[model samples]
Target: MTRLGVTFVATLCFACDARMQLATRTSDLDEQLTIPSDHDLELEIDDALGKKHREDLDRALDAREPGEQLEHAQLSQLALDRQVFTLDDLFRVGDDLFAYQFRPEQGLGNGLAGHVGIEAGPGAAPNLRRVQQNAFGGPDAMSCGDCHAVGGDDGAGTLTQNTYFRGDGDRTLESDVRNAPAVLGLGPIQALATEMSSELASGRAAAIVMATTAGTSVTVPLTAKGLSFGSITALPDGTVDASHVTGVSPDLVVRPFGWKGHQPTLREMIKESFRVHLGIVSLVDQQAVRDGRVSSSLYGDGPWYDVDNDGANIEVEDGMLSTMVAYLSQLEIPIVQPPDDPSLLDRFARGRAVFDQVQCGTCHVRSLTLVDPIVVTHAEQTENTASPTVAIDVARAGMRPKIQAIDLIGSAYGVPLFSDLRRHEMGTELASPVEQIAGGAPIPKTQWLTRPLWGLADTAPYLHDGRAPTISDAVRAHGGEAQASRDAFVALPDDDRSALLVYLLSLARTHKLVAP
Candidate 1:
């Protein structure tokens, strides 16, 4: 067998072993619980559990009277005991879990615990003072699914739901409103970014080594996804000169998650969202505060250990956070769904050609290849061990889906995420006054990452701020590096323009519970 085949077999065997170990652990836990043999009875139990917790939550909220405050332990116990059926239970289940997390629900307490009443205002709830002082924008929305409900579940946001960021407590001024982009197909996008970053870093490192050994200045062109970031010149004395670097970090890492391409990883994005949107801090962020790496002041005016001061040091556990990331990473990429009408299909085909002709593919390059597919596993570690000795299939983490076949657009794994994952200088019209800081450096106000066009049709109210309501508006809004392409698009005849739009619309993938 080929080396690749051998490696594949070995990995498969390891994964299967991990799953078996997890099953054994799960069986042991099941033995401890007085679970019903009948499936219907089990569901009934789950519903009863959910209902009881809801009642407990209400009682806790009531206790938060003028002089009464519920402790963290009371709130923690009130959080519904998450049902674990299969290994997938370790993470989030796409069906009801997705629905529950996204859909707006009553009595679901915010990060402040049941301290603040569900209703907003100081007069209505005594704990409102604590909320107003601590929480960001005072509990902006109930669930993440609430805001991102435009095209479908986890879709883009509307103008009304625009997130006001970087403000001094007041929403009227000193804050910039940003529209939430769709979270679909992020797994492949992240994988592609990781690969591209490694390539750029390796190139710079090799250039630096050559310069130091040869005692001469060496220059390395920084490139990723066929786009040039800039060049780095290394001197003989090992002093590196990066005066020409642009878009990406001097370290050559491409962070392709946020609007400004700021977040290095999806995990970081999730952590920040918990703090900013939900006003919840992850265990990881809490540790950063305790170690004095991050200031406690940033988390708001609360207890040093428990920022929200609900007495819970950890707002969102690491395992829960990891599960959320896994759920997001596994979201299916949008697929091309051409209209059944022959005429429309023809138009879509023509528009696709026009899309290439207009050079939109230059920046929004058709597709990217993942160097390594994302794989996450959860397990316990033995004391004094350097690494985890036992592997377990938490959320079926060890069982990765088969990589999708490449499409005509050149997307590997059949994910038509049309983006080069590079930052470009958008013209003044689309530029924002607020500068996005990433890796301790401020990104240019006008610079933005190439928005992936995979699910363009579904994600309406386009552009960074949802300024453009249609795809055509977004196309016209393009400037700076995209000026020529935008001009070409503008000059196109009516039929051709319509065809291009049709083709873009075809990129919308139908929503599914799980990726096939």
Candidate 2:
């Protein structure tokens, strides 16, 4: 039941023209796209040769300047006019982990426009030396791919000017929280997203995000436009979901993993990937740095951002945090489905024993192990050659590689496996006080986190902010702490939940990477 592919109009038209500023067909704002009559999304734009890229989105929204704005020099002139703020070979990585920013035609485009970013408007002021990090412990933060991106092609290469900050308010977030979660196909959805870790109950139950006006401080830029990445709305069954962000508090529901989900593994979410998305700081000794409580009046003054023109004042050192967590823990998860069929591997081993006789294997737990492949080859030789040791010990001693654990034959070969990496409560009839975590609280509109369910039959409008679509309407829209595992998967019998939805549409698959 998973075959929805015209390759989803070229992966949602290259993820909606690289997430936002839509209307593609090589858009230059393609007649400022308005098709939405609830377009529901299929996106096609030709509108008569879309008046040829409207002067390249009006010279990329009138290129600004404040010590060379949106640095990496405007994503290298929008990747020399292939356009849309360039940096898209779908995040490359070839010449042996592209030897730290290689050069030739400079294909990796100076480390992919040094992680793409530059929109100084919306009242734009806060660059206070690129607001380093405060994360948990709070205030001062910046990590939208530290400009726009980092590394891939079998991974390791992020270093967008190492920055840091710790504890002081008015908005700071670099205690390394991290939220990338879009690795394409993550090796058969890392064992069908850890089959919901057998009703977890322990992994330290994290997710905190406090500070609602307590004397009114302010400083929250990670971007999705001013810090509010959760909240969708509209449901009396019209299904929109995600809606709970007012003074938040039920232990902070961040559940995206790390600095809160406290690392249950994506190899500890790729060793807290470059202090969770570019606040830098990663030698991998792990945790310790605290100090907070200011409230207001603290914006400039001290070593922030003129980084070096000898206007003097230095202090930065994330140097691409262990090469962006060794090119994101050796990326290569994209398997989606290739075994091709040996009687569909005996009906995926009889839907892997009816996904462990429902209880969805208690918070989706199955096989485990992956955390030490010599700390993932010394975090990919400390992210490409500052040399932390790389011989690949005879190809990891004849391919011992780990990161696997899937189910439903590894998501029918791709995603919807169901999760358990941690974080769940799922009740306020499926809550959404606008998603958050890390102390400020409010994460239990039935608190959620065990939702990996890889490519759940080709990315849809599902939970964790997508809200449910199918798979029995996301198991009858599961209720609080998954209402006794959705009434034990609705008392199974209908041909064992139709053989567990034919073992979750045989865990569909697609993206590919594998080469070490």
Candidate 3:
């Protein structure tokens, strides 16, 4: 068990008519967070919060009227004014309210939102039989943090927690299992993806214009952060041909969020995850269902406002969604921990050289420097969606140093996130039976975005399916474009192989302090 000392600062807000001051209190407790432990650390931490605070939270939750929206800003002000809350109270209240275990009396109704036969609305069917079949059905887990709690608090999931999709409720042979990836360093990844997408789109657009004006076909090379996504051929007819496009979407947008790189932004990913994994439909999806843009069958019944018919709307209102995204957007990047022993340091250095010599660095490009770190706030349009925004204090959100390291070669904000963020052919062995359509085109199951290795040391049971028990197993499992690299790794001398593994293990990330 890990013991953490956390302090909370109470601020008095007088700007608004409501005079509130967050009450100040201190408590020393053992915080069970991160790594594999013998005990149920999460439950222990929750129990450690004491009965009084838990009751207060329960009362506050019960006080909310059904269908009423919880104003994040207002609640935050109240929390600060009340000062008797824990540090978790400040961040988890608005974003993780529904994440807590709920009882029937609390309006959650048996606390199993995804159980089949639960009436959604008037004459509506029970929650759909299949998890991930569509939004508002099957409920894989109770909360987002539940699946992502393998290595640590908010870490990746284990093989047991792997989500099975495209099948009946039972784990049938037809189901496809997807290993949950860690959510760390996603803020920088989103920023890098946004930049790469803009660059690709701009380059392709220019090529099209030039080709049309010249009355000749022009090939535009779509390259960003040292990764090439083949090229786009612009014909003289003012139309673009994407037959040569290898990696990204035809629109040249780089979506680096999902396993297939389908989700474009963190906010979008959060909303979709809420709907698909937890059956917490967002207001946007609800409206889409109401407008017939989405099938009403996807969600159960008639009362569109309360699709799940769980008494409260509890549909992950826009404010709650934005707050969750903000929390995710400010997560710390994986830090590379150097070995304390000199001999171990020497071995790690040798392994890093061996890694580069074996050509594994080709797809796993070490770092991509950002000209300017993209700061996504609630007030700005970060993605293509029209979702409502909320202003989040980045400093207060608990983030490590924005710039992980400096890339002199790239001369930008160095992000040592060991990935090119481009899709690659992963060969038949890793390919799925079904195809995933993205940006109006069918994506081959074998093609996937290169998995970033920044937090590789902590997140184990590697690969998209958590099939590999060790790092070496994951390397050996690599095929297609990485076949040559895998072969080289296999052929390396024993000492070199050990060095390489040591080097990889150095890439670790620690949990961030919710409060100082």
Candidate 4:
């Protein structure tokens, strides 16, 4: 929320007769401005957003084209102008959140508005979805709530499917790859980040809480209310989401999307779906030029080559993009309350305190400040500048989300949710490339986000790679940076160990009671 480094907080939209389109080379500046190292955590917190901070951001934005600059300016300005959210604002963005709630049918594998046929794909085909790839066997590009819910939307809307992806080839795939991990206690995790950053003057989490910083970039446009990201892949046709390919591929355990497998965040996975499933692209993805794989007719334009002479049209389904983004950014990760049983609650409280004490919370940050839900103002030419800024007052505002508990869907929760969110050489023992990483050292691979631990009781079969079978097994497998924490965990007495496990389990329930 720190104005990309500016001191200014609020500014009314100013009208301009000319559409200012400015392009500046921000790559260097961006490379220069990274999450500064944490000497004293408190100092890092205080410096999250400082006037000098915005200066660095200013240099970056000023270099961009005017349009990009304006977008950067407005988004930065808006971040400052908008107040850091209270718990209530966390759920609903500009208006009542419940207004945007969907009927059971409209989520996950279903089409827009709960329509059945509208959301059809190869994943829906029983034959294609059943193939197992050992750790790699399962559907590739699946959606968030697909395997996370029970029974595909019973009246209560919990994912009942314990469907798991079978591993293929030679590996002993321990990952499930095709099941629903309940979304119970994500609130506390988000809150953890919020609490950490709240102490700093700038109030921004300086630590890297994202999956990867490899090609990360942030921009706030004047006409847009929130963030827009580019697509992950656009290959083998306009298909974006991963196909339900079986046997021939590698371990499905690499599919981190759910307890079933595949590890993709809503932000990344959804955009992929938009491109492949719906054929839509946000402004950020406009640069993605497709080649001969697709036709210009799909995008309603001449075969204008964007980057390479790839004959594919770069058109994206506009309506789905905005709505889906709205749904995701606004989608509240459920909340959890402490258990009523005194013994259980006490165990949870103690574990919670110890979780932070051991520095596990550093990597598994609790909360992240999301920019307000953005409403993209698409105009042929720059239309009415005066009233172009529209606050998205969706119906789903009343539903206030708070921390809740959920189960560690896979086997890696024992790692204290401390994930680097970057691909590390897990060694030949467990290494499997979920995504291709052609650049830099090490083989191409998909990096993963640290799994937040607000809810640990229900979600199981943890870890991005999903190699562990049980919590203890997962704990034993921790290497790399997590070794110290794992050692600390293993060194505890039986009671202490049990207490910690209990505490971890306690974090697994949803606490917030959303407005119906």
Better candidate number, 1 or 2, judged by lDDT? 1
Q: Is candidate 1 or 4 superior in TM-score?
A: 1
Residues 1-516, candidate 1, lDDT per residue (tens digit)?
A: 133643454455564654343333223222111222476455556644754564455456646742121122121111222322233442333222333431112212233433434433212211321122222433455456756777876788888787767654444354655788888777677677777888888778888899999999999888865678789998998878877987786667799888889897766787677566655556655666667777776664455555544445555554444455556666556666565443354575577789999999987887665545653432111121232211222112322332354556433453357777888988998887678778777788888998888878888888888889899999999999899999999999999999999888877756432211
TM-scores, each model vs. reference: 0.73, 0.29, 0.76, 0.43
Identify the candidate with maximal lDDT: 3
lDDT of 2 at 259: 16
Candidate number with greatest TM-score: 3
Q: lDDT for model 2, on a 0 to 1 scale?
A: 0.33
Candidate 3 per-residue lDDT over residues 321-389, each given as its tens digit: 555666676666786655544346557657778889999899888887766565463412122144333
Residue ranges of candidate 2 with Cα displaced over 4 Å: 1-90, 93-182, 185-278, 281-302, 306-339, 345-441, 444-446, 455-479, 486-505, 508-516
How does candidate 3 fare on TM-score?
0.76
Question: Stretches of candidate 1 above 4 Å error?
Answer: 1-87, 90-138, 377-403, 407-414, 513-516
Better of 3 and 4 by lDDT: 3
Report the candidate with higher TM-score, 2 versus 4. Answer: 4
